[model samples]
Target: MKLKRYLWIAVCLIALAVSMLPAYSEDFFQHHREFRRFLQHHTGFQVSTLGALNVGVYEAAATLAELKSHGDFGLGTFEGLDGEMVVLDGKFYQIKSDGVAYPVKDNSKTPFSAVTFFRQERSLRLTGRMNYQELRSQIDEQLPTSNLPYAIRLKGTFPSLKVRSVPKQTPPYSPLGEVISQQQVVFELQNVQGTLVGFRLPQYLKDVNAAGYHFHFITSDRHKGGHLLDGAFLNPVVDIETLRDWQIMLPSNTAFEEASLE
Candidate 1:
């Protein structure tokens, strides 16, 4: 009789526990989703602005190490418009006018740069020969919307690539256009395997950032590349990292304060 009573109580306890589980399970899944969203919060971050560069504000807005703290992938120029900056897979490269991609020191600073912790939200497996313009168009068609910013990456052998890098500047810097026209060193590579890093910003970011695609290239060997002027991608797999938002870290220095930014 005692054993039967104990068994009855044990069954009752389990039935009560099972009846309470639905509420607990709902809360558990809700918290799990919140944690996953936290992990997936990718953002595009930048130091300085295109407006500042346009006005020749080529001062170190932030150190490379500080920039890396925000994200692992990006592109920008060193202090004084020195060369071109390409940050890929948490590694920073400086492609100087001589067309050499050198590893950047952490203490080095940048005048302008944009970076994001890349996590591919969408990917496209492209085919046939696609030049820069065609590649942009194809990506545009794949985009769900143009209102948001995106970080893009492509790694493969490029049939043709034309890139350029600018020499370092001194005080009394000239406008970016004039400097590029005067001292930009152009390099053309054939059948080069490498990675490309860049961003697609919205038109609303005009003065703060470029309104369209801007990319920088580095060879697969991580030795040579620069501002991607043109390129032909064949059967390339492109990855797009959707950003939750974008942020710009302005210079605390006087150049940014004194310069007239439009």
Candidate 2:
């Protein structure tokens, strides 16, 4: 009889618990919905004007000309304009040409400040008008104190510098090889500016006749492995060596011969 009583009590407890499940679930979903609504409504403007942009920073000179011709002069002036921040209703818009303010149609395109606008443009895309003040507040709360740009200096300079228009240079060795294991790795040359160059890495060394900057590549692989690759044809080479014992290697050509891993 006692066993049966215990079993009956257990069943009753489970039944009671089951009966409360629906109410709990309903409350949970309701709470979730409310939270979503709050985020959507309260921060809608903030979210929409996340990455508005006016022009690319690299094209600042040209953009400044355009702005001077078409954009609002009261917004700012151009020159020494390295970056830009397009804001509307106080939100982040875009990084672009310095000193040039584009006409923002809505609040959905602005980034926080010039620096953020430039960085954000690399990650995001804006389509509409942005609020300047609202975006600014969001930036104030979210960004680091030191990172926030003020009116004192060139605050919005990224958009103007974001322009990337270098002619493509297809490498002869389209696919560079990875450094071999056990090989000491060091940068022999890096053609970042692409001044004297060629398709072949060797040819570039020959043309420039100089060993460029070198960075040591210390890999964990016992067989010393590293990648000699670039996002663009930015040919950069590495020399291989053991961790304790390092060796210096330079280009075979006389011009590059002088290059040293200093």
Candidate 3:
């Protein structure tokens, strides 16, 4: 009887102690639970496929406002492959072939793009300078697995950055390959402080999106950037968000229906 009483008394003390915790304890726990849910439910959304773009399907499938309902950070091309797209902090930007960045209107349309809510899982600070390939390789090594897609954002002052953009095509569209080679404009920027937004996708998604690392850059002032081709990071921090699930919205157009994706 004495032992049982003591055990009951101990239980009561524990319950009291828990109840005496600061009122914020409950709120903290609630926020923690919500954050966990965000991490688990983080999703990547894409509009149209690269294969469709390659086949000359330039019609808009989704508007900027519609995309906001899906994700805030991502990259893609405007309708007609007009320019490079760099999405940051829920703001959409169109970097034209002229190497100029413009704010995208909510009604603007995209033919091929991918986006995510950007719930960061980790951040990395490099100890030495790394170029495009080296930076990707390093990040690759740190990923939990090679099978999942990851959204990465890196901000820093770069030594050199090479980017390009394609001119907006007119009616009677041409294939993407031809447009890129003949109409693309490249820019070389040095000592520029900016944020690089991109993703690392698995090869299995080749038909749906970029198979490897794809990135776009925008200056800190949110102007003058394009599709990132190469760059050197000087020990900057990289933010990473893991996306275990994805949804792709195929265009409901004749071109997409008839494209020779095979």
Candidate 4:
């Protein structure tokens, strides 16, 4: 009986030592460390590439396959200003100058884009009447701070919505401002149900991102949308997600490298 009890005790000690071994502890710490890093960085969360001003450099920098891996919700424009790009629920749609929304192919490319793995952190119901600026002010009050980036989605009906989509441009591209001035197509809709996808970038990111609210609207029927210019919301539901991390992929091509970024 004594020998048997001693053997049992010895087994327990061996098991304990194995559990406490450096290799086991190392693996344990390594796993947790990686997990912590993921939470801290929020891999594939919010990704933006090329500044808004770089539209003239090269419009198509990365493919849809690569952009989708970084985020499922966001907005951008296609190569050569072909159309407006809206990413919703993991699918990418292109709103062309013809006032139609089409599914972008996986091989499609974009010049400037911003996207995020959207996870709403807060929601609000906006009632009564408010124009674009008023709505932005109300949202500003709800924000925890203006120092961080935010992804905003407004769903429901809009009594009036005005938007524009620029046509495709060829090589020897003019500046974006000039292109939009000369080639953008405008659309006005009434009593439309749709969702507005947008982002509020901090002032510090002015050169790198759109400094204020940059929005794109897609109708409920998934047939129409473009870069938002003005709108009045009757009673819309707003959902917001605060982006805590950001990643940017720069272009390696010669066009972007030689472009005068000043």
Output the better candidate (1/3) by TM-score: 1
Candidate 3: segments with Cα more than 4 A from true spot: 1-41
Q: What TM-score, computed on C-alpha atoms, does each candidate reach?
A: 0.86, 0.24, 0.84, 0.85
lDDT per residue (tens digit) for residues 1-262 in model 3: 9999999999999999888786668889999999866754488999999899987899998999989888889999998888999999999999998899999899999998999888778998776988889988888888889999989998889999999999999979999889988988999999999999999999999888889899999999987999988888788788998897888999988878887899
- Whose lDDT is greatest here? 1
- Per-residue lDDT tens digits for candidate 1, residues 86-170, read 9999999999999999998999999899998888888988878989999999888889889999999999989999999999999
Candidate 4 per-residue lDDT over residues 160-259, each given as its tens digit:
9999998888998888888888899999989998889989988988877788899998998899999999988876778988777766777667777777
lDDT of each: 0.91, 0.23, 0.89, 0.82
- Tell me the lDDT of candidate 2: 0.23
| Residue range with the least summed lDDT across 10 consecutive positions in model 4 | 40-49
Candidate 1 off by > 4 Å: 1-41
Badly placed stretches (over 4 Å) of model 2 are 36-82, 87-92, 95-98, 102-262
Ranking by lDDT: 1, 3, 4, 2
Model 1: how large is the Cα RMSD against the reference? 6.7
- lDDT (tens digit, per residue) of candidate 2 on 1-262: 9999999999999999999999999999999999854433221011100111111111112232222222111121122221223322232122232212233322222111111011111111222333323322332343233221121111111111111111111222111111112221223222122111111111223222112211111111111111122222211221111111111111123222232222
